[model samples]
Target chain A: MKPVFTRPRSLADVSTHYCPGCTHGIVHRLIAEAIDELDIAERTIGVAPVGCAVLAYNYFNVDFQEAAHGRAPAVATGIKRALPDRVVFTYQGDGDLASIGTAEIVHAANRGEAITVIYVNNAIYGMTGGQMAPTTLAGQKTTTSPFGRDVEVCGYPIRMAELLATLVAPRYIARVAVNSPAHIQQAKRAIKRAFEVQVNDHGFALVEVLSTCPTNWGLPPKKALAWLEENMIPYYPLGEFKVPKEAE
Target chain B: MAKGKVVINEDRCKGCELCTTVCPHKILALDPKKINKLGYHPVTLTDPEECIGCALCARMCPDCVIEVYRE
Candidate 1:
């Protein structure tokens, strides 16, 4: 019989620590599938960060290394340098990548490391209880910013992909979303392409996925998805931020 | 009246069984017999004739392999 659904081999069978309704699981599956489709699972090495996805190393079946908060890019750089033939990537959240790890990612991209970075942006910090993250939109309320993020004091959100695009070293950079089925499909394509870029050794490739943190957002799973579409997508519209024509 | 077809992209299937686990109408099930390219037993629409086009399968497939069309 033809199969319609099943687990991707790229992901381990361990239970994820993510909250129910969080799209982290969905995004994880997409990355795993891309790895499998590209036949790079054996050659893939991942750096798991310190945010909600800190425990992601346990979920992916491939070799994974744990990195300090916002230091995944540096860790990935080291691993890629040690095993240049292997496909090296990092899985990071908005807080870990956009905030503390900002310098690491910027420098790695600037140096043109042959690596892939999957940046998950759910606006707030999920592991630490919905605190205001660097990507949190102005006027958006978080645990720290209960009255909403104030542009006057808290400042505006940082578009990490756009920032990375300004650098000349990155070969490919795209921002995708996983809010709806169609969008999820599109995101998988983008993710696969990101891996393809790394497999082809096309310098730094980053795929920023606009995901949902329903538990932190204090919304139901369905509503959280809708909120992502209504708010986040508009703020970070999906597109190829920077793609080298030869890599395309 | 007949319902529309269910399409599964073989490469996209991860064999998570979330779709089979969530189908309230119980129209989907793992073959427990077949192995896909990724070498896992994937889910099969057990009784395609009984499907209601609910789309629960499509929603649950984390790999996005299930595509449902209502006729």
Candidate 2:
């Protein structure tokens, strides 16, 4: 009998520790599926970041390096430089990417490093208990802002994909969500293309996935997805932020 | 003979409530129910029979819920 869907070989058999409704599992599956499809699971190296996804090292079957908060890009840079022939990517969350690791990501993309960056943006800092992140929307209530995120003091949420696209180094940048199955399909396409850019040595590739943080958002898994539609999508606006002509 | 009911893995919903907003028939609603383990109220379909199978709700849902089928 043929199975409709089975877990990807690139992912370990261990159950994930992520809270119910968190999109980390979907993102991981996408990455693993891409790696498996590209036939590069053996040659791929992933850099995991601090925050909820830190244990990503254990999730993916490929070799992984645990990096300090916001340092995955720098570490991935080193790994890709040392093994230029292998596929190297960094999986990071908003707290690690747009907040503490902003400099690293900007410079790495500025340098046009040959690596893929899978950035998960769920607005609030997830693993750290829903503190307001740099990507948290105005009026969004996080642990840091129980009432709401006051733009006067907190400033506005940063659109990392658009910001990164402005730099010339990145060859591909797109923001897709996993809130729905259709969105998931689109996200998978984007992830595959990002990897293709790296495998083809097309400089930097970044896929900013608008994911859900049910635990931190104080919503159930289902409503959190709807919230992304109601709030997150309008602010972030999904679609290809940037893509090199050659890759297209 | 009937097709499978749209299986909603409620555990995976993020409670964004976009599904309710997109339902043309307004069959779905974000009830004022208490929070789940994740701490947000989840959406509940009030009248499943009224669903038109437009799938607008499914397409609009960011968390990948709302499966549709023929009964």
User: Candidate 1: TM-score?
Assistant: 0.82
Model 1 ranges off by over 4 Å: B1-71
- Per-model TM-score versus the true fold: 0.82, 0.80
Candidate 1 per-residue C-alpha lDDT over A59-157 given as tens digits, one digit per residue, 9 for 90 to 100: 888999999999999999999999999999999999999999989999999999999999999999999899999999889989999999998997899
List where candidate 2 sits over 4 angstroms from the true fold.
B1-71
Cα lDDT tens digits, model 2, A44-153, are 99999999999999888999999999999999999988999999999999999999999999999999999999999999898889999999999999889998999999
Docking class of 1: incorrect
Number of the top-ranking candidate, with TM-score as the measure = 1
Tens digits of per-residue lDDT, candidate 1, B16-46, equal 5556645667777667888887665667877
> What TM-score results for chain B in every one of the models?
0.83, 0.74
